[model samples]
Target: MLIAFFTNNYKPFVGGVPIAIENTARMLRRRGHRVLIFAPDYDGDVQDEPDVFRVLSIKNFNNTPFSLPLPLTLRPAYDLDTLSQVDVVHVHHPFLLGMSGLQLARAYNLPVVFTYHTQYEKYIHYLPFPQQMTAELAIRLSTRFANSCDAVIAPSSDIRKTLIERGVQVPVHVLPTGVDLQKFRGGQKDFLRKKFNLSAETQIVLTVSRLAKEKNISFLIRAFVRLCTYNSQAVFVLVGRGDAEDDLKALARDLGIANRVYFAGELVGKELVSAYKGADVFVFASTTETQGLVVLESMACGVPPVVVDAPGVRDFVHPGVNGFMVPEDGEADFAERVLTLLDDEALRKALGAEALKTARRWSLRQTTSKLERIYKSLSAKGQPRGKRERFIMLRELISYQFEKLLEEVDKLF
Candidate 1:
């Protein structure tokens, strides 16, 4: 099967979504499926991945990191002949490229599926519009786009539930963008110790995430500081670089724990593996994640996580088995849980073993095979969404009428 993925960004952009798209595409290709990624060009540096078609885009349109694709320019630049050969269109974002892919899918008479990758409502603060208004608009747009698709893919059951709640009237599949278990499991690296100047006796508590406000990273830092109050030997290693780096560094310095805190900026490949493997336990506080891929990655490296309980994080964290999940309200408890794992070597080892076992279940091979099954099922159905087509058309008509009515009402007022 030839699957074309339309996303806002791709390689060199360090994030979970890109990682998912890249890894999933690679694994699917390995499983005898051709995958092509349609993404905005991040600069002149082209990715080494084969068959990635980059669109012309304007950089730094908003205060956000994502580059906005110039759809008019993109249309001309796209290889429509090659795109027409695609069996399935999978869109990872809800705007720009998403609309373009839907248009392509219609023109080619191909099935288009959408993945609800991010919590758009949470990121509405980036826009200049009113927060509530922007969030509602984003939801409406997401719902309409998702409903138009032949099928919807959710990274976790939690995201699927959100999509359903937001009025996505289509088949939703709860398929996580799985981890590359082998990468984390077998790699050996002495970089973490040498780079950070840490001794064998130092206990490393690692957390890998973008240093963004939405990540609740400040909360993690506070908890880590408290954990240090109990376990002086434990060192906190916060990996990944983002906007909040300076603020987080100041917070650590203010707490007089700067020496104990190591901010390893944006580790990839072997460095990332070393960070996961060198850690005694993984600590995360992000409340906004469709699926915490980093948690699974850490677990695969035989490092159990002590994460604040959120819908996505709960899916992987088992209280006593693989990792401990602290309730969203329990910040102090989160710290204690980290200290517990740091203090008890035997319990940490036990949990790490269980974590590795759990991580094995979410291998990329298994997830890609499941995705292939979804693709085959949709393809075998011929018209793909025959039953839902009429319903979608009717819904669009009603929506059009409602918008017209609202516009006329506004004119009167």
Candidate 2:
């Protein structure tokens, strides 16, 4: 089987979507399937890789301070020809590249699948208009995009429910991104501790995510300040960098927890695994994740998370079993739960054990099998019905035009 993945962002750009595309494509290739990635070129930093296609792209709208990659189009002559040869199309995002993926599927008479990766409404602040206006626009556009796809992959059942609630007519599949358990099983924490100059008796609390507003890092810092009052020996280490780094650092200093907080800026490979293993507890307050891959990574390393009760991470936390899931508004509760895990050694070990057991169910090997089955199922369905396909193509065209109008209006406002 030949699979073509369409993503707005790729390698060298830090985010969950790129990682998902890379991991799935890698595993699919190992499973004897030909895989290709169609992504936007960012600052000439991306290198030529086997089966990967990078198109010349530019960043227009200064939407966010993160310098996000916003591609112009995917209709280049060569790209069209390359896309025409694919057996299946899997799109990671549902706005720009997503519209292109749907159009390509129509042109090639192939099945197009979309993975609903982010909660669009939660990110409307990037636009200039009032969030309410942009949020309504986001939901309408998202629903139309999902409806046009042959199938929509929701990383969690909660997201699937949201799609159904928003009137998505297509089939929604619950398939979260997978974690490589083997990578975490053997990673030693001592090396990381020594490198960071942490004392053997000090406790570590970690949150691995892009330092962005939607990630709710500010809320976590405030909660960490409260947590420090209970346990001064604990260190809060934030992994990954983004536009919010300076503000987060300043906030930590203002809160007088700067000495207790460590910004360990994006550790990959064994170092990342070691950071997870060395931590006594993983802490997260992001309520906007489609699927919290870092939560599974933390659990895979036997460091259970005390996360806010959000859709994706909610699927992983089973309270007293694996980890605790605090409610969205429960900042105090979130801090208390982290303190609870920190104060009790036996309880932390028990929860961590359960977390590892739960992590096995989401191993990359098992999730890849599920993805393969989805691919085969789409292949088996063959091209979409002729009349229905034409209607879908027409609807998508109109929807794309309408979305562009909305975007223009947003810019004007």
Candidate 3:
């Protein structure tokens, strides 16, 4: 089967979404499927994956900060002659690339599948509009985009539930972003700690995420400061960088934990793997994630997570099993949970062991195969029949009405 893997960003523009797409595409190709990636040109050398095709040279918009590509001209390769050759169009994001893929699929009369990767509504705080308005717009846009696809794949049950609540009539499948087991499991703990200047006695509480407002790094800083009251030897290492770096640094200073917090900004490869292995506890406070890929990476490294009991994290971190889930924004509870894991070596070991086991369940091969099955199922059903097509058309009309209503509301306020 020929598969077109569409995404907003790919390679060198590192993130969970891109990584997941790369892994799935590679695995699918290995399974003897012809795969092609449609993505924005990041001005990097293309990888030499025989079965994978790269379509480049598209113009990018909002190039600063986020580096999102705003496609100026979109023509399906060979006037969608090649697109017609593909059996299914699997889009990883709901924005530009996904929209392009959806349009091409419609033109070519091909089966379309979409993966809901991010929680767009949670990130509305970063937008220019008011939070309520931004969230409503996000919901309407996401619902419309998702309803277009024959099947929607969500990384967690929480995301699926959110889509259903938003009136998505399409079938939603719960799939997780898988991790590389070999890269993260065991070994080199002491060497990693020594390399990072961290002592064996130091309790390393780590977080790896793009430094963005929606990541809620402020909450992590506040909670870490509170945790310092119980454990002075605690060290906070933050990986990744973004607009919030300065604000976070200032917050750490104000909390009087500047000396304890280390900003290890934007690490990859061995450095990233080592950081995960060296940590005593892996912590995440982001509420905007559809799936927390870092949580799985940390778990694969046998580092237990102290994450919020939200959508994506809950799917991986089971309280008293692999890791503890504190209530969202519950700074006191977050601090206490970290302290509990840090102080108790026995509990940490038990949780870490179980976390490794749990991480095994979400392998790249397993996830890709499941996605393949869904794609095949959709392909077998072919295009929507008379009543089904009408139903979809009606849903699209309702979605447009909702979008107009949101626009009017925005204009009013």
Candidate with top TM-score is 1
Span of 10 residues, lowest total lDDT, candidate 3 = 385-394
Clashes of 3: 2
* Residue range 217-248, candidate 1, lDDT tens digits: 88887887778777868888889988779999
lDDT for each candidate structure:
0.82, 0.82, 0.80
Per-residue accuracy of model 3 over 202-295 as CA lDDT, tens digit each: 8789999988788888999999989999898999999998878999999999989999999887877777887888889999988888999999
- lDDT value for model 1: 0.82
TM-score of each: 0.92, 0.90, 0.88
TM-score comparison, 2 vs 3, better candidate: 2
Location of the lowest summed lDDT over 10 successive residues in candidate 2: 385-394
TM-score (C-alpha, index-matched) for candidate 3: 0.88
In model 3, the runs with Cα more than 4 Å from the true position are 43-64, 76-79, 125-132, 185-187, 381-413
Q: Report the C-alpha displacement of residue 221, candidate 1, in angstroms.
A: 0.6
Q: Tell me which residue pairs clash in candidate 3.
A: 61-70, 240-266
Candidate 2 off by > 4 Å: 60-79, 128-130, 381-413
Ranking by TM-score: 1, 2, 3
